[model samples]
Target: MGPAQKPNVCRQLSRRALGFFSRDAGVVQRTNLGILRALVCQESTKFKNVWTTHSKSPIAYERGRIYFDNYRCCVSSVASEPRKLYEMPKCSKSEKIEDALLWECPVGEILPNPSDYKSSLIALTAHNWLFRISATTGKVLEKIYLASYCKFRYLSWDTPQEVIAVKSAQNKGSVLARQAGIQQPVLLYLAVFHVLPFSLIGILEINKKIFGNVTDATLSHGILIVMYSSGLVRLYSFQAITEQFMQQKLDLGCACRWGGTAGTVGEAPFGIPCNIKITDTPPLLFEVSSLENAFQIGGHPWHYIITPNKKKQKGVFHICALKDNSLNENLPTVTASGRVVKRTFNLLDDDPEQETFKIVDYEDELGLLSVVAVTQIDAEGKAHLDFHCNEYGTLLKSIPLVESWDVTYSHEVYFDRDLVLHIEQKPSRVFSCYVYQMVCDPGEEETTNRSCEKETNLNIILNSDNHSSDC
Candidate 1:
């Protein structure tokens, strides 16, 4: 069948309208309305607010501890009180840092130590500085300068000892270079760092002018998948990239050198060619039509790419499965199979320009994926947590989050099994916790028995009251 004629496997109701029904009621009604008896008997599940906290700075939760921007707080479920574990030292003003404190730093990403998350954490600032802080004492253990004129946006742990960082595609320097007749290739910098000793392993630069601007990149199952604005998706062997960077680091005798040079020759002289090799094996490439946003659920073999249908105000999801044997080799050349299926869902609130959607969590057993839909109305920030069945794109539930008008700050949501934790910043920080639990409705027989018992109790109460009045 042609693409246009294919039926929509999943259709969702309007968010505002769906809020009226019970959570599971909406799912059952939409999926199988013909089974009226089953729908009436099935119990509904909903999220209940468990606890909330207010923090002076941004917060992240892992295990049982709540990690603030500069310190770690130990919080227990039974008690909402937070005991401060450590506090990091303030940044020196002599350094001319944009934000003196780590929590308030601009364009920063913080991650826990993969080897020992409870002992240490890592923070990457927009100024290209990486800081490793002790979680127990809040002391800066190690710090390294990555690169100048480079702005990093994302960080992922490749291994317990290694971390990978990617540069922002909307970097001002690259944008200006493209417009100023200096076609410097707009290099996409990917830096690898060693966590324990705290050293830069090496840098991998991709020529964006040759390919296209990077829209999204992720590391999964030892493969690096990068999606470009030109509808190109390429999978590279992350192990191969790391091996090349290690070799270059050994040859140059410095962490930041390129092609046996003393400094980063690639960035020092703009457009200057460097002999640093990226990878010996060619990357597996897939050209997707109208590809805009793409991401993979960790530990899953499926890669999802979204294409916006502006005319209909919908987003189409193209689910593709990865080959089983592709990532087994030393120099992995991963390839995606043919498109498995296409699922369509409405754009956030049916407005193409006002809202954005991002996949936040995926439940493997239930085959459900959670998406955070953020919409800005009249400069006020509003968001909803949407759960959708991955196979059919059926929206199971939509829960509205607390509203915040602070557009400058972004909100964070973390899903932990049946519990969800969210952090938001308006002027200060607020942490909220929700638990998904079953709300059982009495069965027909149980309901009848309860009604009889209540009637008998009412008669006894009436008789007692009448006797007391007469006396």
Candidate 2:
């Protein structure tokens, strides 16, 4: 018989969970495979219009195209057969759909120097920040100017002809006023921005039943002005919007507004260098003045914290356990494990945080591991971990990963089943990026603990792949 193929339980799990998060908050995966497949795989890897917003009736422009409200551009002209939402589409003139550069498109974050010429600029919806996309490509053309205060939350837009889009993070949505150039969109609101980029950004609203709670709250639309980037309020948020638009002609660095009106810049108002300071968080801004020496900082923790640099490039990311956090420190080393233990992980060539390397050839072969590391978006957001593992993994000791974590929580629970625990994952990216297991129950501890059994052990690893050989 031919060599056995590895089963793909992991991918199966990711897909199902993803569908549940994006569409029905109530829709949950029956197993771990469902959540793994859905979140990790590129939305393109699956069907298109899997969710209502992607579909026509559920979410489409007057032009009969998938209106990317964030950038205010038609994603593509040659629409897909609504049925084939998961199938890939050929490039055409009408819409420009790109999955490869979705997460970390380099140009979007590339900061243009003083010499480089920038054509037009606009603020995003929630005043989260602003950006400059390629006038022609809508690819973040350049990032020359930015405000350096208050984090912009989200943004929504309302065009002249009844079109709407919200701009938040890559995972969050942005409203793109594709109609008028940087002149300022009419009837645009600050709140109500509920769409992500035209990429694989998926959201799982656990607060309410996915798309539930439709109250007068939830910030769908608003108008406000900023005295500065701080919480200091001005008159009408709309006044701030109007003033910022007019200033675009005079002030080279004030096209974006903060506080509430996300005019265009995604982070423009938050990082602007003009000495016009806004709301400053906590103590004075902290900066790592030195980087030659460092000290260790973790002891058998469950998850490690990775501080993202303001500027990012392309590359592969191995699991890391930051050993130190002193004023002077060397780069932290990652203890690569989990799905990354066997395969290669690549970062997006453009922007590292927004887009990641989507695996096309390895999905069916690697299973759940693929779902975890098809390369992932490290965008600003929140998520949590949930798991129940078997015994073989539970027995291992002094695991490299367990000691590598920068932070871990200790929560022991009693169970009726005689099951030893081993598996774990970070519930949220904003909380902890990954989860590690360590220190199995001792014989004495087992006798006292309800979850573990001292009499017998269990191993949960699966057998050979069935699809490849059964075929």
Candidate 3:
């Protein structure tokens, strides 16, 4: 067979060979062929919108249900179609008394119960109230007040009994603090709590004088990474923090100071200069940082900092691989292998005015051995979902996500198998859930039509030349 016909002939041979093999062997051969076909046709991938739903609050998807907070917090089943499963009771006016505790605030974050992920969920509200609610019945099983008037920015659950950590900031010039004549800067609080029984563990009060304002924080594999506005990044040992928490159990009311003795493993400057012009209202001080439990590269950890340049309309991802040097020291010292910068779009020939880009969300799935999946939005309000190779940050694949731009709304996205769950939060206390199905687009029909037309034209040209020769 010729080079162009070899593929077809080989496919025919494979099908015939499959009939000769046993049923189990045929199944294996078919699976291998499917993988081969996918490798050969990687660029044909496309995404289709499957379903969309509207809500009054931010939505969280777990398994087959979508959880959100509204007048009454509720969970909706989205197995086949979106339908309300259950709604929690609304807080009565009498129950809204000053002394009364209520879990009626808009939920800022929703996390699955680590022990019972399927049936229960833990929700943190905008008012710093944490509640463990039943996923099926929407019943408030337990709730705890973290801190009053504390603006929480980050929430994460960590190992060693799955302790939850919440990062919040309280302005010193607030009503209570100002009345007390406290002239210090904004106090950053990292509250640790247990969800099983819903009890406060201990709060880590970050020293602004030493660490500066915390821009971002994440916990992974017993390691706590805290990034500051001063361009400083610090790593802490969660085990050491737990030990200190145990020691200060009697004085849990008083916040424990961070650093010095509280699990200061290693510290480093982010190294990248903060020169980007942020376009957010009030202007953010620093770029967002993400820490991944990257054990693929020599079993070491990796973290990334995405800096958005509004003027240039680009996102510069600073990737650093952390090496464990704990054997020499008592605690693990995180040393970066090197920093790699990956730009979202090509700067050499790309026009900034045409498309302004911002990274809304990105995830690093270390377990799946897949590289980072980034969700980027353009100025025209289109979501560009792409995956990049882990080592050099090369483009792997782009899955088109359909979206419209609304300045009054914000977005969050989650990827699971072949489904993409996009949640958009609006200004008037509403959110929208959009689910997309990822599939391969076969362009064989167009290719076949074009090939047939070309062959017919060529045959006619040859026949006319032969007629002229005969004449």
Which 10 residues in a row give candidate 3 its minimum summed lDDT?
265-274
Number of backbone-clashing residue pairs for each candidate, in the order shown:
0, 103, 0
lDDT of 2 by residue, 1-471 (tens): 222343365665566656634454334423444444333332222111111111111112221223232234333223221111111222233333211011222234443353223322233423333343433344454332223322233423432112222322222123453343332211212222211221111111111121122111112123322122111222223223333332232233335553455444323333432221112111221122111111112346422323232124222222234344332334333322221123446534664333222211222311321111121235332212212122111111111111122223222111101111112223341211111212222332312322222111110100012211100
True-structure lDDT of candidate 2: 0.25
Give every collision pair in model 1. none
User: How high is the CA lDDT of each candidate model?
Assistant: 0.47, 0.25, 0.47
| Model 3 spans with C-alpha error above 4 angstroms | 1-48, 70-77, 92-118, 126-129, 145-154, 175-182, 195-200, 207-228, 241-346, 349-409, 425-430, 437-471
In model 3, residue pairs whose N, Cα or C atoms come closer than 3 Å (at least 3 residues apart or on different chains), thus clashing, are: none
Can you give the lDDT of residue 162 in candidate 1?
51
Alpha carbon lDDT at 177, candidate 1: 73
- Per-residue alpha-carbon lDDT of model 3 for 1-471, expressed as tens digits? 111221353565576666754579656566555444343325665555655656544566665555544323343433323445665554543322121112222234455444343355666555555666666676767655554435555566664335677666554565887798865543566666654545555555554554456555565555656675544556666556556433344222333333233321111111111111112222122233223311211233543333332324233333333443222223223324233443244557544334444443443322112222323345554545665433334455666555575544666666654556777878776667776655565652323343244334423432333432100
Report the C-alpha displacement of residue 27, candidate 1, in angstroms.
33
Q: What are the RMSDs of all candidates, in order?
A: 17.1, 23.4, 18.2
